[model samples]
Target: MQKPRLIASDIDGTLLDPFEQITVRTAAMIRRVIAADTPFVLVSGRPPRWIPPVADMAGLDGYAVCANGAIVYDIAAARVLSVHGLDALVLHDVVHALARVLPGIKVATERAEPGPDSAGAPFATEPGYRNPWGDAESNVRPRAEVLGHTATKLLVRHEKMTSEEMSLAATELLGDAVDVTFSTNRGLIEISAPGVTKARGLAEVAELVGVARDAIVAFGDMPNDIEMLRWAGHGVAMANAHAEVLAAADEVTAPNSQDGVAMVLERWF
Candidate 1:
């Protein structure tokens, strides 16, 4: 098989291990690929602030499809290359309407905040429940007053309800105005701007890099990653991936705990 010129990967459950850390083997493989001038993109539902550490760890200096494709970020430059956001008015209306339907549910907006380093701002003051990826102490903040900034994505966290239930409620309430998907197993729902997704984000990155969509490979392991996986020339789903993701992909790799991404790189490179 012809090797892809670019690789895009979802972070949480596809590239990272169970503890959310990238394995040494994966890191080395990423570095090797980057050294070979292959652009490795980290396409994820994570906010811009939470992406740098992962990018740095992987030795990638390309763009990140953040907030499920609501924002495409130039990671090396620490700037937003493009953004698809919900207008302030629409965001407020949706939040309010969702609150009425699912009382006590946490509603948070993920945005780029000024960071302490040259890597740009991290996701600041997410208003919803704690981050479900075990980074609660870093990403969680107290509920605060909502403002009128453009929202890259809206996150809903419900303790007693399943993500499927919350997603259905959101669809019923908001209809086609927003796109919703879940990346974690913690019943959190991520709502993005209509028509925006990680696949679209990868397309944008591919355009900027002058790489064709058919020259890119992608890895993912959840429902949120289905479109991205299907969009790539070679889509690889982790062994532990959702059925939908597995069915959509071109192939399956080892589980995340076993360094599935690294195994693919080893075999391909």
Candidate 2:
């Protein structure tokens, strides 16, 4: 492969190891890649608040595509370069539709705080909806307060349905009015504006950085990463990737715990 111009990677199960930390070897590999003048962009289902810490771990000042593809973040500037958020009206409608179809469903919206403290991304979620990991610096409030404004992404959860099942259901009900995807945690579905995905976010970054689609390499391990993998010239899946992601990828690497990302970059940098 002709060396990649832009390297896009997913966090959690893709870049960080099982411990959710960037290993020293992985950090060294990232530094080497950055030294070669390649831009590393983190595209994740996470909010911008979770990105700065990961960028620091990589030992580079990089940008991020947060909330799936809804927000593009400039890490060093601590600014949101662009955002594709659901309109307030649309958000309200979708929530109602989901409630009608899935009674007692939990709804939460991820709002980008003015900033983060020693605390991490200041998330405003509904009272009952916790993250996939069961831990986040989340502020739980009444649904009235949570759904009153436009948001980057919405989390829809049900006690019985996995995110995968919820994703299928939401897609069937909402169709193109909204974009629905999920994470490793199958408990909740994350909603974005129509047509937004990791690929769309990466495309924006590639344009901003002047990298062609063919020269971009992306790594991912979930259904959310499907479009990004398809969009990249070299789309790699983690060995532990979801079945859909593994099938969509051009290649599969070792598990993230084994420094799969670093092992691949070594071949290039």
Candidate 3:
């Protein structure tokens, strides 16, 4: 494998533990990676509003590829450098499509605005869509209000089916018109613009940081991280990652609970 110059990792299941905190070993190892002159980019399925705290927790302020691929955030400045989002019509159409296939699915929109992160500046999501990461500041607006404008990302959730099941049900209904992925193993799916993935977001970061794609290594444990892992020089899957994620990886590390990311970085650094 090429000696990597950049390191990109997915946040929830790949970097953060079950409780959403970076372990001491992981933090120390990330410090080591940055010390080795390689930027540690947090490529996640999170909205831009959620990046700062995670970066602060890691004690690293490298770039973050957030909202699947719709946002490229500069964590140090707490600003969005770029965004690729779905317009109101697109999201409305998606809601209709999913509603047809899966009845009563909850829809949440992370709008691109001000006051916080990305276009979903303050985050105006619907009531049924709980913030999976325990968000404290989401505006529980009506579903109509949430879908009234363009959004950096759209979140859909169902009371029953797992994310994979939801994906299967929406497969024909959603062909390649958009990018759909799940960070968690539950009934939630995050949607971004067509062809947008964390890999694209990281590409923007690469251009800014002057790191070649082949000189980068990435880690992930969910469908959202699939393209990113495949796009990197080394795509590592966590031992407890989804089956598709495992198949997509060049190697498999320990589970997140075991500090998988830190283990790999320790060896490289």
As a TM-score, model 3 comes out at 0.93
lDDT of 3 at 251: 94
Writing each residue's lDDT as its tens digit, candidate 1 over 1-269 gives: 48889999999888889988888888889988888898989999887877899987777778888888877887888777787887667777787888899987876676654334534223434454665665554444454433255668777788788787787788898888888888765768888888889998899899989998888889999888988888888899999998889899999999999999989888667
| Candidate 2 residue pairs that clash | 163-186
Q: How high a TM-score does candidate 2 get?
A: 0.94
Judging by lDDT against the true structure, name the best candidate: 2
Global Cα lDDT for candidate 3: 0.84
Q: What is the C-alpha lDDT profile of model 3 across 1-269, one tens digit per residue?
A: 75589999999888999888899999998888888888999998777767888888887776888888788888887778888989988888899889988997988887653335334344777887766556576788887778888788888988687888888777667989988888875788888889999999988999999988888889999998999989988899999899999999999999999999988877668
Using lDDT as the yardstick, the better of models 1 and 2 is 2
The best candidate by TM-score is 2
Error of 1 at 86 (Å): 1.0
Q: What residue pairs clash in candidate 3, if any at all?
A: 111-119, 111-120, 112-119, 112-120, 113-119
Could you give candidate 2's per-residue lDDT for residues 122-172 as a string of tens digits? 456777776667755677778776777778898888877777888888999
**Estimated TM-score for each candidate:** 0.87, 0.94, 0.93
- Runs in model 3 deviating more than 4 A are 113-121
